[model samples]
Target: MNSKFRALTFILFMAFLRPALSQSVENAWVRRPLPGMKLTGAYMVIKNDTNKDISLLEIQGPDAEYYEIHTHENIDGVMKMRQLKKLKIPAMDKVMLKPKSFHIMLIQIKKGRLTKQAKKTELTLIFDNKVKLTTETKLSKGPL
Candidate 1:
């Protein structure tokens, strides 16, 4: 009976602690799209500590008509960008959303917006299980 009670207590403790351990963000930023271009990409490092995998379902904007999770694939020695329905961040690990790897594509950007002059922006990440995490991203016009 004592062992059973201890197990139950452990379960309850982990449940309450899960949210605190769920997600953390690092080095989040948006790369300024080329002049007059309709698309640009954002990069970041997402760390997850929970025991379950988390799926990044969507990215909400500081300035964009829309967003998509995308990755570059090498096909026949040629690289192409493809949209992902969702990007998964593995449990107890981190995912780097970087240029030509995995990234958030900001589409149909508002003209003259998100320029380096703007300096910074906020992006709200919506994950599976309805978890939303918002982070400020620097607006940059440089490599990686």
Candidate 2:
């Protein structure tokens, strides 16, 4: 193909791919489970830059048997955790997944999947409207 034709093709391809990258996951971090423990927690920032709301339908971690979204609430001066069916991120906004707020629970994790040392763990973030994104979480013994 001619040089001009190739340049045009590249521009068209990039334009087709722009919308897919508008959403992003940032500051992804997962707590390393203690020895003999079967669970851990994960946190991240989910950004929705589109004009419509996005709902986080599910999360899948290879190191864990399952995952669930959770949130903590103050009830009568006591903190309680409840599992959330789904987490929503409004358009042009971001959802911060952290301790004492919206977070992910990695349940029944396989032994030795993560250690005390720092490691990179992959998790699949499933969203509504047929969106799925995978992000790597740095694993460590975090205080939160």
Candidate 3:
């Protein structure tokens, strides 16, 4: 192949690689929950930049006693929640955790104090590869 032809082919390959290289977590935010509510849900979209499957293993927060991965399903016309062992996100895809769906269950609020006053709670999401992503979430009042 000529030098000009080879250079054009290389340029085309690099153009196709740009989108994959730019993949990242975008607009990751969770709503603040109401007071007296023992549990709250987190929702976010994860954009997979690479060509590999990612599994979300766990989520944790400092304000709660413990956190667990959960999914809401309609079984026999009744809405029920079950513990999720792991959440899987396909390559170049997005996973959304929303109300009445898959979500992170934050349980056991600290005693004797309302959640509204709490500050600087760290939400750590652990992936299957042991990659931990932390997001700071604030508590709010009202139903999610």
Candidate 1 minimal-lDDT segment of 10 residues? 16-25
Per-residue lDDT of 1-144 in model 3, one digit per residue for the tens?
A: 699999999999999877643234444444455657776666666666667888888777665687787889998999999998998888768787777787777777666433555543567888876777777654443243
Compared with the true structure, the alpha-carbon lDDT of candidate 3 equals: 0.69
Against the unseen true structure, what C-alpha lDDT does each candidate score? 0.88, 0.88, 0.69
Tell me how far the alpha carbon of residue 87 in candidate 2 is from the true structure, in angstroms, after superposition.
0.4
Candidate 2 C-alpha lDDT tens digits along 71-116:
9888898999999999999998999998778899999987678777
RMSD (CA, Å), each prediction = 3.8, 5.3, 3.5
* Model 3 residue 3 CA deviation in Å: 1.8
Worst 10 residues of 2 by lDDT: 110-119
Candidate 3 TM-score over all chains jointly: 0.74
The TM-score, computed over Cα atoms with residue i paired to residue i, of candidate 1 is 0.82
TM-score of each: 0.82, 0.82, 0.74
